[model samples]
Target: MMRVKNFAHSTFATTNHQTMADAQALLQKADKKAASGGGGGFSRFFGGGTTNYEDAAELYIQAANAFKLQRMSKEAGQSFEKAAAMQLKTDEKDDAPNTLVEAYKVYRKTDPEDAARVMESAIQMYTAKGNFRRAATNKSDLAGLYELELSDIPKALEAYDVAGEWFSGDQAEALANKAWLKVGELAALQEDYARAIARFEDVARSSVSNNLTRYSVKEYFFKAGLCHIASGDLVATKRAFDTYLNLDPGFMSTREFELLQDIVTAIESADQELFTEKVFGYDQLSKLDKWKTTLLLKIKNGIEDEPDLT
Candidate 1:
């Protein structure tokens, strides 16, 4: 067993060293090709001599792959960035954005800021090319990196909002709704209930016309109601609830509607226990997600924050 282990370790070390050397060699050749400013002797003779960015880009990609094989994510990401730049300089503008996406995927594992930066470049390229769908998709990804990786809530919210608009303009209502949901959830986290409520209401209104999304209208209105409750506007909450019922008449029969009604009643009476009970009861039947739980807690806290008339 010891002999076999020793052989395996030797083989692994040899392979790793060879891979490193190969990557270095490829990188050096790529640099030389980029600086040469001429394709080759034959191309010069044919009057077609020019900077060989195409070859340089391929070499950079190969080096990036080699770095990835060695688990050098940062190096791999940098190589991919170079490849993307080279592709942009060549006639391969279409491929440059994809190369940047490759860079983003690698950078996200090691450096979120770098990932966000490259993703923005990819999004800009896609938009410039009139590929709003791809741009919107990357914007959503960029928002996730900001929200989850960097914890930049404001930037995340902005990115999600832009993505939602782009998706809506592209007629990708489902994707737009998904992005808007994130915007609403984050806005609520920031105590921007008006923004949250508006986003949710917009989604609900848009969804009511689409058979595929109509079923989710109730959930969106429920969320908007929760935001209104959190904002301590019972009158507006009641008004919004009435509007929701009118918009989706079937919502009045849902457990979500019941919970909202019960919570509104509990808040009016300053009954925290009743609020908790209503939420708990609804949770037992239908599990509340983190966003819902958070907003519910905020609404519950508003009860205690309210001044006692007595």
Candidate 2:
């Protein structure tokens, strides 16, 4: 007989190892009944006409914990996947997607391909249930997995856009903004300046319209300006700067903002030396971030060649 580890008013948290052993034995019994089409499995476990796959799912979860405790990552993930599948077969649809996500977490560290597969299953389940918020969150996770683990930028970008669409449709403004920001950043990384600028501008306008935060609008405008600078569109950068000044009530004439105007002025006066010096000066004072530095370098490279568009 197994000794009880702890007991409360109406429940207990058993010792995991003992529970694992018991669950393994029960799973064997369940597997035989499941295969034989006997009365021992889900169809009769709860004494109801409705199936009760929860018993099998609980056993699978216990087995997963056992494997995880033994440091067998692959087996643990497989067991969790089994649990998720069993959960889906039950009447509890909401918990099934969550169970699949648990399997995904187990697989993510050991096998990204397996993780991606599990995440796709979770996404489908959530979408089918019209749980757009959860679906969008899972899509964002999948996007990160593709970008960071699988090194698939195009797929990552596509996933982010899909996540953004779901968030937007669900009227989740903050989440939608985050998803679209990823899409914009990826577009900028791919040197698609126009698309990046458009995405940033849209978010910035939305932020203003919804009265989200002035700082957020400033940051988006900052990003849009960098993208315009990257595309060597000095006129557009100036216009974006003007729009930011108009919107931000707390606007100050910082060197970061001034550099945009200076760069425009330098190009109009045909002074490549002045443009370079002003940009470098801003870097010395404010220390540009890597993304800003990258776009600034691109601007400096083409500044002398591109005619004044102001």
Candidate 3:
């Protein structure tokens, strides 16, 4: 950014139109390289990759700025569009759904309705590529973008359901967490708790996932416990809460600790709730186990951040 500012200052100070134009050209080249998945990374230590949209976006964005600097709005529009297309590639879907989100960033002048068309194009591209995971995820994302910015909830749900179909294994956990956490507040929203619980249980039960306290696992246990409690299935509730405690025991403040005791006192009746709920406990109903990673087989993927768009 400092370099950019310095270059701008130098370019604008020059009386020679030709020199100014040349400077602009260099900037354009850099942008083009960035859009083309070239140039240096965004953050050198954790920089650009072909799989990331930033690399592709930087290129086309540079091209757009070049056109804009030259007072070529039409040409700039074209570059922005090109950037959008490049960003929407199936492999780069993780970065953000280019068809909608990326396009909005680059082509802010475009109508929201038009953006919907672009999103549709992205969905089609995903589907055509035969990457069901991306297709479903992007479709759901587009639906969300549409609903939020365009007041189109029905369309949004449709997109979410489309994504739901592909939400199996890792995909399933991802989608269910999204459904549970983000849309959980929506009264009209309906989550297939049975299916989602199964997916969460898959993660909870799997030996593959390690001791990480990720939101995914947390949501899984939390939602399972909530579902059991809602159904009055004390045993299932206890089990779910037990799993929760197993995952995160440190949340037991003194008051919460006593609550666990009260719930445990009724463990017998609670066990009976198992007949109704197929789960255990009246609480997420026990003291947390304080880092069950101690006993579990932990695989270290070493991924720290939850990722922005994922």
Candidate 4:
């Protein structure tokens, strides 16, 4: 066993050393090519200088892949960035953003801040080229990085909102709604009920006119109602619920609507057990996601903590 372990370790070390060496060699070659392409006074005057930016960019990309093989993420990211810059200097402007996206992917595993910065660069390039769909996709990715890695909820919300608008402009309504849903969820998390409600309602209203998204309107209205409940405004919740029922008479038949109604009754009577029972019943049929469970718990707790006014 010890002999086998030692052999494995030796092989791993040898592979890593070779990979690093290869990356360094490629990087040096790329640097030399880039320097040669930088037309100096004499080279420019003599007209003998021909930019090797394309070759340098290819070498940089190879170096980046080699660095990745050695788990050197930061080095890989830097190499990819160099490749992107080289590509930008050449006529391959389209490929430059893709190279930067590679850098963003590399940085994402270890350095979220760097990842966000690189992704923003790619997004800007994409937008500048009128590739709004790709820009929207990257913006959604940026929003995830901000929310999950950086814990910057506000930035995440903003990014999602922008992504939704871009997707809508591109006639990608389904994708737009997906991004808007993230904005709604994040807003709700921030306790910005008005913002959350508006987003959910807007999506629900839009979805009601489309056959593909019609079924989802109930869930959106349910979420909006929950947000209203969380806001401690029962009147608004009831009014919104009435509007939802009128907008889609079918919503009244869904278990989501029933749960909303039960929750409202529970809150009105300060019946914590009824609230828990209703949620548990619905959950048994269709498991509640973490977000929904959290909101329900908040509502239940609020009912329990209500002060007597009699």
Instruction: Predict model 4's lDDT versus the native.
Output: 0.91
- In the range 47-67, model 3's lDDT, one tens digit per residue, is 544543455555566656665
lDDT of each residue in 45-119, candidate 2, tens digit only: 655222435666776777777767655667778878877776666666678778778878878877889989989
Q: Quote the positional error of residue 171 for candidate 3 in Å.
A: 6.5
> How well does candidate 3 match the true structure in TM-score terms?
0.39
Candidate 1 per-residue lDDT over residues 1-310, each given as its tens digit: 9999999999999999999999889888887777764465887555323447888889999999999998888988999998888888776879999999999999896899999999999999999999999999999999999999999999999999999999999999889989999999999999999999999999999999889888888889989989988898789889998999888889999999999999989888888889988999999999999989988887888888767776
Which sequence of candidate numbers ranks them by TM-score, best first? 1, 4, 2, 3
Off by over 4 Å in 2: 1-52, 209-212, 234-254, 265-273, 304-310
What ranges in model 3 sit over 4 Å off? 1-104, 107-110, 133-137, 164-210, 213-219, 224-310
- Model 4 clash tally, residue pairs: 0
What TM-score would every model get versus the actual structure? 0.94, 0.78, 0.39, 0.91
Better of 1 and 2 by lDDT: 1
* RMSD after Cα superposition, model 4: 2.4
- TM-score-best of 1 and 3: 1
Tens digit of lDDT per residue, candidate 4, span 1-310? 9999999999999988988999999999999888888574787456423357878999999999999998899999999999999988776879999999999999996999999999999999999999999999999999999999999999999999999999999999889999999999999988898999999998999999889889889899999999999999999889999999999999999999999999999898888889989999999999999898778778888998987655
What's each prediction's clash count?
A: 0, 0, 21, 0
Question: What are the RMSD figures for all models against the true structure?
Answer: 2.1, 6.9, 15.8, 2.4
| Best candidate (score: lDDT) | 4
lDDT of candidate 1 at residue 243, scale 0 to 100:
94
- Which of the predicted structures, 3 or 4, would earn the higher TM-score when compared with the native? 4
What value does the lDDT take at residue 177 in candidate 4? Answer: 90
